[model samples]
Target: MSELKNSPWITCFLRPQELLLLLMLRWAIAYMEDPAFPHLGDSSQPLPRACPWRCSCPRDDTVDCAGLGLSVFPDNITKAARHLSLQNNQLQELPYNELSRLSGLRTLDLHSNLISSEGLPDEAFESLTQLEHFYVAHNKLSVAPQFLPPSLRVADLAANEVVEIFPLTFGEKPELRSVYLHDNRLNNTGLPPNTFLGSEAITTLSLSSNQLSYLPPSLPSSLERLHLQNNLISKVPRGALSLQTRLRELYLQHNQLTDSGLDATTFSKLSSLEYLDLSHNQLTTVPEGLPENLTILHLGRNCIRQVEAVRLHRARGLRYLLLQHNELGTSALPAGTLRPLRALHTLHLYGNRLERVPPALPRHLKALVMPHNRVAVLGERDLVSARALAELNLAYNRLASERVHPGAFRRLRALRSLDLAGNQLSRLPEGLPPSLRSLKLQRNQLRALEPELLAGLKKLRELSLAHNRLRVGDIEPGTWHELQALQVLDLSHNELSFVPPDLPEALEELHLQANRISHVGPEAFLSTPHLRALFLRANRLHMTSIAAEAFLGLVHLRVVDTAENPEQVLVQLPPKNKGALSPKG
Candidate 1:
């Protein structure tokens, strides 16, 4: 045939079977235009339908599939998914047509799955009519999930086991705005009244850790942050938030609220309330129609003994007044009762029973946490009008360094932290405020340290004489040279048998743990070169009494604790190219 098609052994065996059938018909037209190649009836496939191969189409409309232990629901998802993250999967059920062809789904993050409201199907999300932000938070939902999707706007059922919230379950969701039912087990007859009647675009309403004693008078006057904290809410019935007059933040803290279940005209109709957490409630008194544009008033652990200046005369823009652990003493605040709080700046009367130090306060008071009171004297007018006092926690009071009166913190010249830890101080309390930078005299009865007891404290940086009775000749020689901004030096449970030489070269943390330190002088931390934490735990050294240049020039020594010392005391430090000490246990 045409001379056997110009015969060269039939052109090398039939043109190698026609070049292997034209490379198998061009790889079957690129495997039918690979839209992840499975659909064989290719009607002009250009490649767009893929997405669910253990999900992550980063953009042709997002399908994240978080924590893929996905129990089900990832059946080739790409119907042009508009943000669909099945978060922390093991997703039990959502099958009412399982995302019914994702009608252009908009943000559906099934958070921490195991979805249960009897396995979600009251028309499970009714074919998501362009759903808007629906995170099913930590699921196993007991109720609150009805037809939903009137194009819902942010409905996170937080830590769910949602013990009922049915009335229209967000009543005709008028584009609902932020409703997180927090840690659910919701009580008070499981929320009924108009359960958010016609939610006029709600603005953040988290019903916190529930077992709610009461709070459903149809909230949502466009609520502006109302987290009902850890509830068992012992009554708030007066018009229960009177239509939330644009509430500005009201977290009723660890509730069991008393004072006969509060009704100070229900927070005086929250005139745009500004942050009010009635802390651990059982209130003895202090809840009177508050909200004169209140600015932060957390009444700590209540039983508030007395603070009546007409209950803070209409809170004139009060600035942070947390009355800590109540039962306030020493005639419980009577003189001018905090002088009408002129924009008071932070005054937490710590674990109250105050014997003194709370007169007139707030002259722009900057942090005055009155620690475990019964104040036994600290004269100089006890912080004379707090000259903008910068943190002064009178720790476990009953002060005793001769009852501390000499210049008692000289008008607190903006004192920077001075907590006389568990007091009864045996010394060192004179003048003090050289703008003191943290000096907590731990478990006192200080046995001595005298360089005029830390002369003028050159901006001392954290020096807690741990469980004091410090001894080794009671530290007198250059007693840590004007503490050159000493960085953390707590001589733990002191009776120091040694190690105290010059010390402060900007010493960074040296807590001699339960000390009886049996000698370690190789210049004992020689001028502490930025020494990084060296806590000699329960000492009595013996490894030839430690002197491998005893941690020489500490080159930023990183944590060294010679554990409970004498096991023949192997102190061994000098390694990190001759320094960076690491033996911390």
Candidate 2:
């Protein structure tokens, strides 16, 4: 057998079965050396693909060379690479001759580069016939690139110095769907009426943060989302949107639009419109003749004084309404102003002049955010219709504890989070919903925390009473017993002389910073064995006042901050693997 394995003519002296096995071994060796057969016995286990230097190939078809700071494009790019990302570089030009070599290229991203219009020849992208997505945003192009590939679907040219767009800049691109040209120098005269006429399939066009002073007279009829915010647009002619029946979302915030500047019938013909934003304008009333299918409307930061239900009568499907930072008063919002909007889910009336909660709110509302208003009281039946209410934010209001009706939040069974911070409440409000999980009462005049205030709050996990007048005796005994699920308790910026007792066992973080705490007893954290973080900065603590066994029961404590104390106290902490004490500064 040894002689047969070494001899070149072994097959001549082998038996019939042995001769057949030798022939099969010779055939396998030849197959292994063949270049066409690159797999290791199975096609699924192919060799690794080629990758270029200073670039990463996450997939065989994708190449990411972003944030390499390369002044020139890298060489040796794979021919089969379909997606090439060269963003956040200093490349000044794109060599079309070399780029044209990638015939199968589908996406090319050069965003945040120094490429200018002079570097892009008229036929710079004509050779990339298979290209679909082209991103050149944050460049120095003074003019948009003409002769774009006909197969392009998304074109991003935002954050450029572009001042002009030729009539054929986006022409003959039937597959185009989105065009982003925001943050440019394009004005009303710079955009020709026929610039996008040939791109019939365009659905989203963003022209925000521009120098335009008026609405474009002509736009693509197939646009579904049109963003024209942060412009100088002051007027919308009668037929400005007459042909945009298929439009769904329109953003016109931070413009100079006024009631007199907008024609009454400008947006009446958009039958498919669902979202419209006219915030930060000079309108004194809601726009009339809104689309019937409109669901969300943003009319905040305007000069509007009243909201006539007749103007919103057409928008029966409206769900989200924003009228914050306006001149709305008690008489501005009538009782039935929002009754017609049965589908309204969220309403924002913050920073208004209203003295009380509006009546006849939507029944199915989920959130009512009216912070920074002049509301002095909450009526008992104000929220009776909104049984599905979950979040209520009345922060920075004049809500005193006595003025808040006992049953104001009784009907809101689904209330989960309530923010009443920055109020004049000396005591906790009564009749809080038992389903609440998070309650914020910071920056108020709260002096006491009675046990009855938290009787049914078993699901409450977070309670914040910072920046209040709370004292050690103000918190009644067994006050925290009802909050079995409490994980975070904030008593910072209070008059507590020591750590409060009876912290919940599930408490994980305790914040007592900026307090008058002078000592910590050995049993301070006995009930909170699972505490992970403790903050006692900016207090009157001394090194001798903190007992050696103060944190004995806290095995999971990870962070203990006692900086800015009277004597720079540093407590002995657990091992490094468990936790460490933050150094005093």
Candidate 3:
């Protein structure tokens, strides 16, 4: 090949039509193969898009057409290049003999096309015994029999028309490890008991969003991950699921899994099950005899009123718990109920009937979502000690005071964001964490903001004080000066008569949707370097006041949401340009 590269006879021996045919074949082959534009060494600037035919290089071994939307598979592609991809196109069929000549081919991807099963080159793939990594997703395959590769390791046939599958469908491809059969028309009954008989070493099987009503009576024992979500499975067989003892992740969400019918003994055999999701069901209570090795458990959006912690206490390794929108009403959680969950990171208890905040929490609790509860007040005395808590969402609770305990959040050294929106706060609690970056305190009855109240939050970014009783007398420069990183400020839905010039640098994404902000000072955000995505949805300010240059410093500003009050934004971007921005308010 090196000697040929230096030969002028090599260029002389090749005909232009022969070169063109070989190049077109190579181009057809290369055009079908998807390759992300490469960067120079470690640099980030992507290479410009172009086909290899456009390159001045003398080599005719490579073709590239990654983003072109071509129709009809390129003809005689295999005679030149070994890899082929026609990604992001509307091609209907594969050109005849185009895939056969590429005996040296290793990959073929017809991703995002209209190639149905008939259009699929059924016999062509079996000939490429040297082929590996076949991806034909988002196509029209009605069954799993058309394409078969004995030396396959990964077969992604998702989002197809496969209606049924048989055990011999794989036909003893023992090396196959991953099979993606999700979003197909296959049902549980359509698969035979030994459907996974020969493929015993397969690990991941995704049948989610299919017609599977229950687990097949038998499955591969080496199965590690089984995704059966969004199906009509009402009952999991007792002996049917005992084979997959090594299964780690099991997704059963959006199914009609009833507590009365599911045999507890079936799940008892899965000793390695770590993740379990049983959300969005009609069960009144969970079945007993849960696995002891489970780690993550999700039982949200159900009719469960009572929780028996003793059954789950055996899972000493349980980490994350999600019990939202349940009826854990008024009942006291048993002592040491969640105490053993030492590895717990996130516990969601929102939309419950608990009238009192629990005084005990895990040592590793990071995110506590307890919004929309019946608790009327909150302070350090009621909140459990979670020094590592970073995001606390206690919005929409009935609180009337702002005198939270001085040490309420001082211990949370890592606390960065807090959402107290839709409360009845008259003032901010004392001693908030200084590391906070985002604060949401809208829809309250506070009369004004005390500039001295917030002097230590140096990392504050987005603060929404909308829907309050704010006034110009409440303004102070220290409040804005202390927030060195303030990007978005929402002071709308207040009684402000004059727009204050107190915002510091980097005040982008401001939301003054509804207020009496009659004037936006010329230097309102003079120092703001990256101000963008503003929302003055509603105010008494006129359109002319917001001259074309009124937003002069915001070179990065692209979207301004003013749709909530048409009279306010239309008074600004008049006539009919109001329909262009994202949904406002």
* Model 2, span 1-585: residue lDDT tens: 444345687667889998889977777777776677777677766777778788999988999999999888788888998999999999998887768787788999999999999887767576788999999999999999877888999999999999999876787789999999999999988898888877889999999999999888788899999999999999987687998889999999999999988765988999999999999999999998888899999999999999999998999899999999999988988899998999999999999998887888888989999999898988898778788989999999999999999999888899999999999999999999899999999999999999998899999999999999999899899999989999999999999989999989899999999999998988899999998889999999887878888788677887888998888787877554254655435
lDDT at 316, model 2: 88
TM for candidate 2 is: 0.85
Evaluated against the true structure, the overall lDDT of model 1 is 0.82
CA-lDDT, candidates in order: 0.82, 0.89, 0.71
Clashes of 3: 9
Q: Give the top-scoring candidate (TM-score).
A: 2
Candidates sorted by TM-score, descending order?
Answer: 2, 3, 1
Q: Which scores greater on lDDT, model 1 or model 3?
A: 1
For model 3, how does the per-residue alpha-carbon lDDT over 1-585 read when each residue is reduced to its tens digit?
334334445545788987666555655555444355443663575554333442221224444444467675554342445456665677777754766566555556677777777776666776677665667778787777544666767777789888877565654678778888888888866777767667777898888888887766777788899988888888887777787799999998898978865766767888999998989876666556678888888888887776666666666687778888888776645556677677788888889887656556777888888899876756775555677788888888887765456667677778888988888888876678898998988888877676666778889888988888888777756667788888778887888776567676777677666766656665655667576676666666565455454556566665676554435443232233334353354
Candidate 1 lDDT at 131 equals 85
lDDT of 3 at 492: 78
TM-score of each: 0.39, 0.85, 0.73
Top lDDT model: 2
lDDT of 1 by residue, 516-570 (tens): 8877877777788788778887788766777888776666676677776765455
Candidate 1 vs candidate 3: the TM-score winner is 3
For candidate 2, list the clashing residue pairs, or say none: none
